[model samples]
Target: MTKPANTQLTDARRGDARADRTTFLWTAAFIFAGMTVTILSAATELQRANSAFPVGKVVLYEITGFLSFLAMFPLIAWLVTRSTPGQHSWRQVIPVHLAASLGVVILHVSLFVLLRKALVPVFFGEPYFFTDNLARDFIYEYRKSVLAYGIVLFAITFGRELEQKRRELAAAREDAKKSHRLTLKCGGRSIFVDASDVIWAKSASNYVEVKTPGAEHLARATLASIERQLGDAGANAVRVHRSWIVNADYISRIEPTGEGDLKIEMKDGATVPGSRRYRGNLNLS
Candidate 1:
């Protein structure tokens, strides 16, 4: 019994460890991709100043960029994961990008002596000291380019993503509004109804019987206008039958009950039939 229990516990622990690894990889990839774009933008800007394209200078810049990208990994990971809002919102990405850009420049400055020394052998047959003339201009230009381009790249990429998220949020809010429940009281009577909550409504000349939640309501509203309102909310408030508008959120279990009958079990313990014509609406939602 103890051996079996230990085996099960070990398996569960391994599963949890794997999940953590996956999460870390995803976070790291997002950070790395952003940094790559920033670095590449800097390279593009340097390329545009093509008149001063020094082979030695470009080679030296490549080495510095490689090292900066490597150092930026841990810096970005720390900034994004350490903050509370960073873990949940896009706000974390802004700080991470700033830190990454700063880290690249700072690391270049701190390791200038060593980087220059290493590049001497790569660009020239013989190794040279950091005090050489070749190291001076290359280091100066490299630092200037990294700062200017890194910010540009981060702003463009991050701004695009932020705008995309904002649009998605706006669309979701519009959808929620269409299906949202509203409560109103008039003449000592309280009424609560959602546009999508109405399963069916019938015209009684001047009054309408609105079927919703778990009861029927007599409200003074036009069915045509209500249908148009649901459309503004989202595709979820689609009309199944001419008289019925069902809330897709309440649908829990859907199954075929017979040759031509389909049963939908709702979260509120209500049963609604899914007709052949309405099956297309279910797919839309």
Candidate 2:
């Protein structure tokens, strides 16, 4: 018995989110540490200018400095997904990438804030946007350095996340190859169904209807477990609605009607749904 690809992805996401929390936490910690270092360095620089600026003041500056970057996390993640990861893993990649990228952005911003302060000690550059300090001068100068730093961080973050996605994709392919094969008897005839042959599967109480190129076969199983077993066979075996799995391969056309309901026509002329809730995964712009 095999599950649909989308279901497996959903399960994978849930499992990965749960299990990979440690990885996420570690990544966050690493970024946070980077930010702390930057803030400390900035404080040291600021201290050179105004020795009266307390250590506690530096901490406060670092905390507030990271605010803009932390707020932009969601936007950055969405941009990355639409720009890169979406193509390889479908929309499933969005949530995982978002979760990971959010952590990264927070880290990036924290570091930026820390470093923003430390510029003076590290590079002897000016710190403020609109004031000539006792040390260095000019608001315009601050703009140039901030922009340069932001560009560099953005590039690095994009590249790092893209690399992570590439690795994840390879792992998914390998997992799919290992788990997506099946042999069954349909109408007294033996048929071998490759993962790709399946357009989707439907559940009928105890038995699941495995729809393939030739015909649909009734297998006694649960769709939930079958979905997991399918692994990365293909995410197109999407859960169009709760009861049906639509194979992405067979999705010939989609038509939008009123009230957020969609009419989808498959290659087999079998019509399914385009419910607003799950449609985002089906055809994402």
Candidate 3:
């Protein structure tokens, strides 16, 4: 038999792609907004603490802060996508996070120093000023860099959890819409089969024997219940007798018996009994 169309599968892939794009854009926007907020807040604090602070230096400091996250957030995105968050223990994540934190701190400081050296010469007409105490400078900034890295990881984890929940909820609703289904016992397991695959059905005392092209399976429901449950799926199936229903699509021939009962021969060479009482239901072309 031919498999069903994959339109839903294609659409699901498209939806996933769209959702990923939206999440990525939102993450980038948050990082840029966060950097802008940090710059403004730093400028405010510096102005209050030192009224005579050089405006150019304060602007340079805040610009470096912006560039820092500009470099770090992409790395966070790559890390989040590559790793399963909760699968790693603190021992694994902490070391990786420490290494990343150090890398971003070094990049931030290096960019700031280089940019200041070039810009200060052109605009301030002097070399950028800094203390010779490199260790002290790095130690102070590394603390803040480590904290920011933790926050970045937290954001990625939270976003992933939200996306996973949304997918589960959507799948639940989709499952609810699938009503044309039957549960059958086959090979010692209860399997859900589409009613469309059933070529015939017969009664078996509080159960239904469902016949497909290649196999007969047992269903836990009564014949009447199975019939009603498969109502939407039985455009080709018709009740030919109180004991049997036949899929018209597989009807090879019908013949009248000398005993007045009708016989249904299926494409698979199986013959099913048909009562005269429901003979009108079998007006097949």
Candidate 4:
């Protein structure tokens, strides 16, 4: 039974949504793991140096910083998707990314400072100050933020490319599976013919005359177009002339004409003309 067009479309949308959710979760996991390791390393270094900052306070500061960066990830992902690397010229992509990175740096620093100011005094007795010099702190944070932007951009870009490749491979496999069946549309009617059942085909004006064991179909398609539709089955179905394509599996005999052309007889008792120009393309064992 054939499925309704709306149901097929809905299923496709659901599949896309599931794939997107999976990609998002994987990306978040990688970012979280990296931030966790960084936080641990920072705490360890501070303890080893005997810094006056409490270890718990340091951990809290790092957590807030990580959250700020995480919050910026959606914006970064949007920018990357809008101006993909290979899709756009470097001149165009570079300026967009640069501007976005600056915006991200400013937003990230502001968020991180706000989170610290709001949480630090509640945890500890003293209020938190990001730095003594505002200008210097902003510049320092910008340097690190830009690096983070680059990393996030690369991750999203690579993930999209990988997903695209996976989809292409999957589509190719599905096409291969469907190649064994040809759908022929005539007027308001549709016919499905197995590739192996096809004995021969010939060009008829704009249409292709496809012959099967006990049926003939005049599909509104060109010979070349119908030939491509055969896909993997094309190996057995060869173009013996400009207007003719014959199935070697159904060929009973190939007789050469005195005029350098050939007469190919099918097991279905049909005959197709073969041009010597395309004779090399046909091989019968």
Best by lDDT: 4
How far residue 113's Cα lies from its native spot in candidate 1, in Å, is: 4.8
Worst ten in a row by lDDT for model 3: 168-177
TM-score-best of 1 and 3: 3
Name the regions of candidate 4 deviating beyond 4 angstroms: 1-23, 181-285
lDDT of 1 by residue, 1-285 (tens): 124988866754454344434444554465557556665766687778774545556546555655544444444334433432323555765565555656555565556557766776777666745445656756675577456435434333343344444443444345446556433222336465665666554444545566666787775545544555455544356455545556676667778767655677767676666666667777633
Candidate 4, 213-255: lDDT as tens digits: 8889998767875676665544378999999998888888999
lDDT of candidate 3 over 1-285, digit per residue (tens): 322469656654455445555555665677678767876777788878986756676666666666655566667656655553586776777777677668877887787777777777776677887558989988887787667667666766666656654654344334323645565544546566667778888988877888876677886556765666566444377899898887788898999985657989988788999888888888844
lDDT of 1: 0.54
Sequence-dependent TM-score of model 1 = 0.32
TM-score, cand. 2 vs. native: 0.35
lDDT of 3: 0.69
The global Cα lDDT (0 to 1) of model 2 is 0.58
lDDT of 2 by residue, 101-202 (tens): 545544555455565566544443456332346224323334433453344335534455445444444554565667565444346454456777777777
Better structure of 1 and 2 per TM-score: 2
Q: Per-prediction RMSD in angstroms?
A: 14.6, 17.1, 15.1, 12.1
- The TM-scores of all predictions, comma-separated, are 0.32, 0.35, 0.49, 0.57
lDDT against the true structure, per candidate, is 0.54, 0.58, 0.69, 0.79
Q: Output the better candidate (2/4) by lDDT.
A: 4
Q: Number of clashing residue pairs in every model?
A: 1, 10, 0, 0
